[model samples]
Target chain A: MSMPENEIREIEAFLFLEARLADESRYDEWEALWTEDALYWVPRRADLDPAKEVSHIYDNRQRIGTRIRQLKSGFRYSQTPASPMRRVLSNIEIAPAGADEYEAGANFMLMELAIQSTRNMNFWGGRTLYRLRRVDGGLRMVVKKILLIDADEPIANLSFLI
Target chain B: MGMQRTIVYDALVHRDRVHGSLYTDPGVFSDEMDRIFHKGWSFVGHTSEVPNIGDFKRRQIGLQPVIITRNPDNEVRLLFNRCTHRGNMICAKESGNTATFVCPYHGWTFGVGGEMRGVPLQNGMGKDFDKSAMGLANVPRMRIYRGFIFASLAAEGPSFDAYLGKARKLLDRACDMSPDGEVDLSAGWLKHRFHANWKMLPENNTDGYHVNVAHASLMRAVNAFSSQAFDEDKGDNSVTRDWGGGHTELDFAARYHQTGRPFQWFGGVPAAKMPDYVARMEQAYGKDLAQQHMIEGPPHAILFPNLFLAELNISFLIPISANEVVQYYTPLLLKGAPEVNARALRQTEGAMGPGSFLLPEDACMAERNQLGLAAQSPEWLDLRRGLEREYMDEKTGLLSSAVSDEITNRSFWKEYLQLMSSFPGAAA
Candidate 1:
């Protein structure tokens, strides 16, 4: 069912905040957006079963923390000089799931200047499905599944918050 | 007719050092495609991929496209992915279960076995055209050792047996992790493109020295590499072995056995997580052997030129050019252990992929190395770490050293030099 206008605005604001945090490489802030039982997945294909097939970024809460720690550690050379990235999200579709859970889908086109290795412009576009639940006060993401446009092909180092 | 073999490999590849040209020169890259890959046997794909007849997957040996197909007789056949008529790729799709490959370029159809089954307009062609001789060309040499398929395009060189030699144990160690003594690759491959030389993959994979330095972030974030063997000073446990014939291993079996623990190699995953798996292993190979297998886990080795039996994952690199390569990885899923296989898939994701915690650092380093190689000042890359400390192991009859030693690098170049120099002044 269609969500209320106020609810939609809150979800959009949360997604925008998450996107900005990730774009700026604000590891802790971006990580804080995730729930205790979080699943941040970047699957090779949308239909890929996590139990059967491997995804690019399949992190549980512990792994999410570890990923954040590594990024924040200052030694993750792949992002020592983090790639300057900007993503534009559009055509968002939001729907209420379970009790307080909401599902939001958005198409994003990210332009990353991959300064780590090749100082060339790397284009990354994908459809993301975000599962957000109302926590204590703010909404937290339970799942952030990214379906990259070129997921099935040979991929370069995507060590960013993408 | 005009082939200039100007590159003297003996001068470039030395015991303690190698020229940077090996990583940058286009001429050298072309030669490697022939001398090392095309002429020599290369790991194609696992047999478990094509379990039934008509199953097929697209593969590449060097740059030549080929198709790995299970024929009607239930035998694995490697067919060049060429339409016998117009030279278009017959099987363009990555993989599928197909009875026959029809070239969309025309109506020329070929059976899964690469036989020229039917032609659309045979009446138009000359009567002398022989369909029997017109089947898709097969790689002359093919061998399967413990379900790991290897193929060679050349008719003769080093036999697959000679190529494998003592290294067969590496495959054995990898396969025996499964309760059924077979590993599966059904999880699929993650192809990570690298803007670096192919040699970097083989050399860096088994180097062992770069782990602490290159993967410092991963070390900080994860408890996976809690092994003392990874530490430089405390070295008696994990050993770096040159398995002779180019095979090298950054062995952690000794370190795991010391703990008397199962799954230490697998990030200390408790045996309780996979009770059915443990019980199956115990029943299959008895308690003692199964415990030993559990303790040891899978092999962390690069099987010579390409295949990397990377503990719970299988990885291999396809060299594209002097400055480019694509490394593919898949979880080494155990045949009978669903629990272990599931974990292995997740582990592979966390360990290697482009976006993973560990391999991104490695990929970055490799690219930086490739970039730095453009400089003419640093003509050589040193491979002399732990030279004095390295010794000949009496048990395995191979050169052995500590984990951080450059013995693995030297071992690779030694075998590489032998293969390159075998055919004097032979141009690729």
Candidate 2:
């Protein structure tokens, strides 16, 4: 069944804002949007069991906290001079929800320009699955799982959050 | 400022430094591919990759691609992917199984054993033409230690055993850690590219000097999220060794497994599951040995020139050119322990996957190193840190040093120099 129009629009706006927070390197604001027990996963391959097969990023809230902490440390050489990125989110679909949780899926295209001794731009497209819960009449993400089109291929860097 | 194309071993390689051209010159990369890679026993893939009959996978040793397969007869064979007719690649798929590989170009078919089976319209060739004479060319030497398969392009060199030497013990240890004394590579792999010379990676794998500075971001993140999970002040005592013949290891398991606290990398397995995991280990091995295994950290084993088996994964390094390399990271699965295997996969994902925090940093450093090598003023890359602290074993000629010592790189260069200099007057 299709999502209600209002829910779809709300989810789209939330995802867009989430992308904006990361694109602007507003890490602290981005971190706050996640629930206490959040899960963020990026599978290395489209057909992989994160528990059995390896993932690009299979993180708990603590791990996400660690990642943000590292990125903020100004020593993550890969992102020391942080790559500038813009993510375009589209095709938002809100799946059925539990008592308070709504599952939202969206397609994203992230364009990143990285300058590390040389200038290179990468266009990464993927489908992101997010689990959002109603918190104080707004929404907070409990899980975000990203599956990239070229997940199995070798990439130079994915230093920035996608 | 003119620099000679020929690499003079004595001038280019020293106790502490190596010439910058070794990282930049395309001619040197070609020579090394022929001399070092072709002659040396480079690892291609594991037997586990093609476990069943008719299973096959394509792998590379330097620039040459070969198909690693287990035929219907259950014999593992390495067949050149190149078709005999017009030198076109016979198979394009990275991995799969077929009783016969048909060249799409001409429908020329070859068996899994690499024998020429059928040629489309054989009547076109002269009556004297023989199909028996034409078959896929096999690599000169193929050997498997435990499950790791290594092949040599040149016909003669050191025996695989002799070449492995002390490195063999570590490989055995890696497998022995598995409850059933077996490891499988069926899980699949992660591939990442770096704009750096191939040598930089093997060196980085064994170098402890970069851990503090290069991986500081990782350390800080882990510490911040997990109550100082990677705080340096905790006094992690690890050691690195040059296990003769260019093989090396950084043994750091003991430090992490101290007091049985769950490591930050594995996330926090439930406190109750910790004992159960130990019990599973004890079931496979006796109480004493299981405890020893638990206490000892897995050594990151780097076999000479190409392959590295470390912490539940194997990395195969393929060089595309002087300034480019591809790293294939394959996770190792323990035969019967689903929980341990899952944890291992999670830990590998957290640390080394393409989007993970650690590898990208290393790639940046390697790429920058490549760029810096272009400068003419600093003619040498230094490997001089902690040289005096190394101790040599008189019997095996293996050298041991602190985990952060430069002895690892020095030993690597020593072997590299010997191999490079073995070429008579100049590199062809």
Candidate 3:
């Protein structure tokens, strides 16, 4: 069955709002975007499913909450110099899974600038598969899986949310 | 008679600022290749990687490329990857299993053990061409300690065990965690390159002071979970522990301890199940050792030069250029572990994999450090934390530290200078 246009728009808005929250460093709000049983998954390999394959970031809601709290705490050394990031998300697609659950996909690019230097641009565009359910008449994510194109590539510290 | 300046072998003897050339100089790096990488026992790989006969893996020892293979006899051999006939690379792939390596350049083939097996045009060459003498050049020496393999390019140095010293316990503990007393390289590997000096990473890997500040995002994320699990007083005492040499442990302050933050970060275990896993670990390793492992947290031990042995996995940092480094990361799985346990371990590895939330923070920090250091201004990077408390232990050949000490950096610089100053012949 096709998802209603209004429902699709809600999913798109949720994705845009979530990305904005992360880019703005509003981690607490970003954490709130997920359900209590929500999962944040970034796979290591393109072929591996988050449910079956190992993922780079397979945090439950509790872990995600901790991550947000850590960002809020001033003790985090990597965050001391505050990495500023700008995210461009586009090509949103929404598909229905169940009566209230819908899967959403989008392409995104995150450009980070730190105190030390400029032009340290890291470009990554991936399909984010989100399992969304209508909660309190509003959509909340149950699982957000980010499958990066260069998922297997060695990476530096991924301090910020993508 | 004129007096001469005394030569110091110890890395700690230098008092004031080290020369800037040490960081930017090419000649100094070459010298490091000879004195440190070539002379010392550098980790090649684990024996489990090439468990079966004819299994082989290609690796780099400093700038020299080598192929480590297991022959039909189940003997592991480390040989230069170059073909004997025309210097063409024998094994181009990163890793594989093969009965023999055939050079594409001249079709000269060598056995898995690097023995010259055949030449395409055998009669074309006069009978005097000694095939045995023309076989692939073997690394100077290869040795294994509890399945971890190491190869030295130089013929002489302190034995691998003596060099590892107190750090052997870390390896021992890692291997002993498995019921079978061995660990194997599981699945594939993750490779990344950084536009930074390779030396900086080892120093940073063992640097505990940077954790609270450099990894604030990760710590904060982990800490949020901790705040609910434990009280304030328990969190305050969490500090970095020094394990002599350049090895340092970032002890999750007590508040985070209940959440098993260290295991969550290094072991990649889930926060929810940490308590159970810790209990299981305690039962396996006994209470005392488990306490030592847990309370001390995971030690990001830099085995001098460019190897970091963390609880989660093994990583080798190879200097590709003056300002570029290629890092190879592989997950370490306990041998003979149950499928469920292995799956859990692999899950943990995946959580902290290359695309992991934790790694991006680390990579960003490293890249930023490189960019910051590239500036023209002579800004002094601080290594003074707990400086007053740092003392050289006569027994372990390490600079000891309490919480948040920069002794790991100090020890690294100490070794760095020694490696930089010593000539190739001197190291030999």
| Chain B: TM-scores of all predictions | 0.97, 0.92, 0.82
Query: What tens-digit string does per-residue lDDT give for candidate 3 at B1-428?
Result: 85533333333235334433445556656656766778766777888779889999988888899998998888999999999877898899878899999999889989999999889879988989888987888998898888878888977766776667677776876676564567776555666666666777776676655555555455445543333221223344443445544445443434346554344444444535546556566677787776656444434577766667765567778777656777766655655444424454444544344444344455556666667666746645556666776666565454555545666676667556655455444422
lDDT of each: 0.89, 0.80, 0.66
The regions of model 2 sitting more than 4 angstroms off are A1-4, A91-104, B1-5, B224-237, B253-277, B393-397, B424-428
Q: What TM-score does candidate 1 reach?
A: 0.97
lDDT of 1 by residue, B1-428 (tens): 97775788888988899999999999999888888899998899999889999999999999999999999999999989998787998887899999888888878888899998878888888899788888988988889888898998999788899999899998999889889988888888898989999999999999778888888887777766534337757744688999988999998877777778998878788889999999999999999999999998888998889999899999998999999999998899998999998788889989988988889988999999999999978799989998999999898788899888999999899999888878656533
**Model 1, runs deviating above 4 Å:** B1-5, B224-229
- Model 2 clashing residue pairs (backbone): B253-B297, B254-B297
Candidate 3 accuracy as TM-score? 0.75
Find the candidate with the highest TM-score and give its number.
1
Proportion of true contacts reproduced by candidate 1: 0.78
The sequence of per-residue lDDT tens digits that candidate 2 reaches over residues A11-85 is 778888998998987889999999989988888766677666777787788878888988998888888788888
Q: Considering only chain A, what is the TM-score of each predicted structure?
A: 0.97, 0.92, 0.88
Sort the candidates on lDDT, descending order: 1, 2, 3
B274-293: candidate 2 lDDT, tens digit per residue? 66666777899987877666
- By how many angstroms RMSD does model 1 differ from the true structure? 1.8
